[model samples]
Target chain A: MDLFEHQGKELFARYGLPVPSGEVALSPEEAVAAASRLGLPVVVKAQVHTGGRGKAGGVKLAADLDAVRGHASDILGLDISGHIVRRLWIEQASDIAEEYYASFTLDRSARKHLGMLSAEGGVEIETVAAENPDAISKVLVDPAEGLTEEAARAWVEGANLNPAATDQAVEILRKLYVAYTEGDADLVEINPLILTPEGRVHVLDAKVTLDANAVFRHEDYAQYDETQPRDEREEAAHAKGLQYVGLAGSVGVIANGAGLAMSTVDVVNQVGGKPANFLDIGGGANAQVMANALEVINNDPDVRAIFINIFGGITRGEEVANGIIGALEAVDIEAPIVLRLDGTNAAEGREILAPHLNEKLVMEPTMLDAARRAVAMAAA
Target chain B: MSIFVNKDTKVVYQGLTGSQGRYYGMLNRDYGTNVVAGTNPRKAGTDVEGVPVFANCTEAVAATGANASCIFIPAPGVFAAVMDAAEAGIEFVACITEGVPAHDEARFFNMLKRDHPGVRLLGPNCPGIITPGECNIGITAGHIAKPGGPVGIVSRSGTLTYQALYELQQKDIGVTTCVGIGGDPVPGTSFIDCLEAFEADPDTKAVMMIGEIGGSAEEEAAAFIKDNMSKPVSSYIAGVTAPPGKKMGHAGAIVSGGKGTAAAKMDALRDAGVRVGLNPTEAGELMAEIVAEL
Candidate 1:
């Protein structure tokens, strides 16, 4: 749900906000062409999801086309926060007279939308919040009333902005709120909302995080490429309709729900074992899904052992037992598995699993026992 | 003696024509809930599981006189569904639907605060509440909850509720009512809301509150208990020292600025005279020890 800076600027442009005109390019030639079209004095920014790109040498202000080309080539494959730069946004540089910060996000405690504004921009707001808390002004907006011009003006004054920029700040705040709400974004941050030497307000940077749950409504909001090579095991699990998120280490986990998957991870870590992945088969589970899950884990070269924990309610325990047996036959898994099944037909499920019981296919009545056994097996 | 729901409460379903709505509706009926009617704009006049399906919450409320509703509307329709139920004068609404846009929920929350102040909204992503042995309204497993009185349960996780209840039942501690507040970014009620309700209920001798990483709800609730409530409360905030910025149990569980973290909430509760559990299984034992001391 995190948008790259270039993507966020695209959204900002859609809302009629003033942004330095820019084009995203993947190559040095493309970057040079983009800079030429935008005229001289362009900023080449490496497009990655994480912040602190400037400190990482991922951003450079090019005075001419040659500098733009050089910076673009250097930033094209630069890695920032584990995300490699695949594109560069070349934008016209503006002379800033002032820099300000503004953001809109949900204030959960107040149960309202919150707007944060600060006269000091282009830096981490946390530092300001910690040292000079008065510099940041927070407004809890009533969603029904929406973000009105009056509220924006009051907020700008509350942030103690220069009196000259108050009216312009208010106008831009209103537009930002509209963009934030209409964009279905969980967060919209504009750092260095610049006041150019010409006294025109322009967005220097746009950081947007859209709510993933609402993505179904925004068809044009393409799914993030995840922009990294996915674990082959997880990719296979995804193909089978199972939610799998891989982590480092060697203990593979399979649980019925997201909560259980997380708890399983915690329990494993508590007992001194690192979980290799978090896999939720969701509400419905049977031999086929179970086989798919086991195959996914088996495919992971890092997995040293497996753990299957199911507190079945609507999902039958016997069905899970059948899955264990079916999966053992379907895939050649060398790692040990510690299984825990509880709830409806649990006795029947355990009985079915009894025949397959071995060091590798173990069953435990309690979560602690299963966790301990999985950890021990993984350690061995 | 329970807070929001009991045996006599008649429940209706809004957006009940959908698969999730009918699924939970059937389970609610099985758990002895008085599921009288449902509402669906498209499937109006039809019956889902022998219950009447009206066109809207108002029409359903008028016809069935159902004072409570369990919603299963999709994200886009959640706003209208909640407002519809509120305008129709439903006293309690359990919004089981997840993924409501924060802005939409903010609008709905503000509307409820102003227009329908008397109404109690449970969740926008929350699992519904259950009065054990009486009525079940949300998505927690029915088989795990045994009807009894003594413990009042509140949790942020749907699965953890089942785990906690199963553990409690093993120790002969039956629940008065279990509320799953749903770990959504925007919830209708805070952890303090359920804590206060449990604090005042006569049948509930002790309380078990399960929280997770993300928000400062547990810290705020713990502060409230310290200042106001005299009831014995035991708590557990999940994801103790979880890696910063990673969501553990729920979508809403994120450790931003380390504000709503397990360690922080636990510290706050410990300083507030509330018993804190080291793990999910210890929550009931801690509650038992606190109640025994009382």
Candidate 2:
């Protein structure tokens, strides 16, 4: 799960990283009060999940209370790359002597935590990679051994930072690694690990994506979950422990696995139809899970037809067919249903649903056939 | 010959005392796999499905001469269980447990590489491997895959793995073995590893690889296919419609920083002379056509 800038700063602060004192504000009035609390000349930044916030005019520096109110009012409702800002982060403005980039991400090829450091910061890392690739220094951090102090020192020197900032840069990198691992984060990036004019290092921004699977170990993550905005249908699906992503389309797709489910969505689109949502029932589909999926899909008024694709591995095809029959009985579904069942006992499963096949309950042989039929039904 | 398992592989179930363990344990046994022992510290000396339960991997191996293990332990206990299996000198371990933390996976994977040389790890969150009529080790249904074929299958997703197998079965094309390399940021076995094994296996003629949006594994696999693989390879990459920056159910199924997109993977595979499928069924059809020619 991705955290907003203020939330990430709070997490970094908890991990003992040097972040400028900041307060989250919800409204223009709150922004004024927060600025006053932090003394004056604060920075009012929009809290959105997307990047290029500064370019989108969602970030502004204010000299006094009136400017703070104006910037806060302007940015709070501004849209930055399709994500609207509902909140603002008011932080005390700092003097910057130099800026550097540091981040930790999983390196799939190396199978280790990758730490990238660059003296050239305040820009896209990709730009650095494309224009001057050697500017960025990289280290593969072993999860077993962790990022030791010596390793951090070596990384700092490798990046070719200003010698005056080496001690402070290494210090912040050490704490940032702690925040990354102990906080169960998938990524922790400080685009500008700035060295203040006062000869101190501080994080100018924080971007962290926590590992959702590791939520079981952290209770404080409950607050983060509460702040995440989900649509009504998505929230309901989440409540039922279902994996769903709502899309603006006509056909509602329900498949057995993630890869297959996404493919089902792609196939629907390929057949001259748009998929309304992507839903995976996961392995071992049962009547209850089927019912929940149907109910969620039914709630979408844009859905004109439903595509149910099942490849029974551990869950037999016959049981899935029965589960669909059972779920249809329990839920009030408006869209016509088309199912393509295969794998273990698929023929037997097809036979069981043989009597129910019709205009409303269509059963196609292949995935392509089922998708074609479903697209036609939705068009009809 | 198969890449991973055959009828001669003496197997032990790690979480045999649990309900899931009992089900797949008996299923593998009934498939004519030489199911020899089970492991449960609490139920030592007890029998599950007539398979003797041992106190640990060491005892199970000593008692039954088991060379392989199928693990059903939960995610948290996985590292130790894998270590235990390795300590007992089991050369091959297929873990079916899902949702293991990436840190745990990285640590254990590194440990296994360093401490236990020559040990093979299949998955921590995958649908194990299957060798058709000879032996069924993982969750792939034995009926979906038949024995004595010329094709080999390796995939990242479990159900997609089965779907590819089912498509082959429909075309009367049997497989030598099918491997699910698991869906995680860092899996123990990779497409290149499986491809190497399949290329070396005499019974295997062609191969199918299923990848999703996430990581550069497919890009690397494309390089491997171009350089080393002599066998014909068909490919299908999922998450073409998946929105960037969203994890599509699988932990490894996300496209970050404009990377790991289906378009990129398809381009890489096509450039490597792979017959890329637009979807799972199409990929299967492509492979079936390739194998028929062979």
Candidate 3:
């Protein structure tokens, strides 16, 4: 869902928004060649999925091609906020006459899309909103009408931009809004929308993050860098086609719904247990999904015990128990599993799970008893 | 006596031909919900659990005089289903489908305000609602919820609500209605919206609100409680002081800029005169204590 700076800039350029000419380089040699081709003064930016790379020393200007190579070498494979820099975006450096910031993101309060244009650019927008809120001009875009050219112009004018730059700013903002909405993006940011010494405006940086749920409509958007290694548990879970997010701690959780998975984590913590991961077999407690979940957790040495809490409504309890029994047979799971299955065929579910009623696999009648037992067992 | 669906509410099930629709529709009917009609674009004239199935929402409504709808359409077609439900004059719609795109929801909200100002949407990712002892339309455990007096439950979490209710059930606490607003980024109804409905219900006395980390919905609900409701309100915020996750919970549960955390929501609720539970286990006891104090 997060686009690298180079990818965001490509979309911006497609929309007729001015962006610094940039090339994505994978190796230090390529970065050096890109700097040489762009002619000496270029900016080498480590492509990561986070902001404030400038403060993190991930963004640096190269005075010469050799410097560019050195910076690229240093930045490549560097970790910024847990995201490893695998690529570098090399852009032709610009001489700024004036710097401004512009972004369009959804505003939950207004229940409409919001666009913020600020005279002060190249700084965190939150800082700007806090210190001098008046400096940032904001406009709420109607979902029906969208961002019109006239409305964008009004926003630009309100930002107190000079008349000459106002029209150009308006044009760029309108295009950016188009990129935001049409592109299924939740955030479209052009940080430091710079007016060059040549009297032309261009986007110095692009940060566009698309909504993941909308990615199904745009199949091409699903292409991502798969080379980066994920947590072993997460990768194992995903391999089985399960949506699993691993967390730190001892209690491994298996819940049916997304909301249930989150609440299970919370409840685990509340009962003095630390959760190892969040695994939602997604309303389907089939043997495969349960096996997949257990395989992911079984791989985790950190998980001391497992909690299988099922409030089966649409999903039958017998099916959930069958999945658990199937997972236990499929994997060499040593950790204790405390289960609480209620609703629709729960008695049958308990009967199915009765065979595994050892210290390692216990079934309780209530959620609290299960939670208490699971936490106590995990600690042991 | 309930906020949304009761015994009299005539309901239509969208996507009634699907396996999910057939199952839950039958279950709802069994729970005493008047499931009058259903909609499936391909399965017109087919009966699902004795309810008439039409080709679309308009025909279903026309045939059955259905005033409420429960949607089971997939994510891709959810927008059109919601639009159709609105156009068909369904006063209340419960959307159980998850993973609706934020843009589509934005458009849905806009269209609702423009064309169907009267319709109230329960959720796109929610578990729907249960008017205890009347009818159950959502994904919550119906057997756990008993029709009774006073307590009103609203939660952003489905499992936590069930667990909290399980705890409350131990103390013989029963609810008038239990609504799971879900943890989607763009929910159809919010915590504040539920609070307003609970406030208006004469049989509802104490209110229990369960929220997780993410979004300002809890804060908004707290502010609403501070200004309005004189009844006892007890709240428990999940994920208290949680470490920032690799990814946020659902699309809706992201705490950025030190906002919408469990601690922050608790503070807001405490400031608003609502009793804030230290943890969910204490939530029911807190509700009882708050009611006793009142």
Task: Please name the candidate that would achieve the greatest lDDT relative to the true structure.
Answer: 2
Q: Between prediction 2 and prediction 3, which has the larger lDDT?
A: 2
Candidate 1 vs 2: which has more DockQ: 2
Candidate 3 error regions (>4 Å): A36-40, A225-229, B245-248, B290-294
What's the TM-score of every candidate structure?
Answer: 0.94, 0.95, 0.95
- How big is the positional error of residue B121 in model 1, measured in Å on the Cα after superposition? 1.4
Top-down DockQ ranking: 2, 1, 3
> Model 1 over residues B169-225: C-alpha lDDT tens digits?
777777899998877777887778888898889988888888877788888888898
Expressed as tens digits, the lDDT of each residue in A242-348 for candidate 2 is 88888889999999888789889889988899999889888777768888898999889999999999887766678777877887778768899999888766888
Reference-based lDDT, each prediction:
0.83, 0.88, 0.81
**Error of model 1, residue B150, in angstroms:** 1.0
Per-model tally of clashing residue pairs: 1, 0, 1
User: What is the model-wide C-alpha lDDT for candidate 1?
Assistant: 0.83
Output the better candidate (1/3) by TM-score. 3
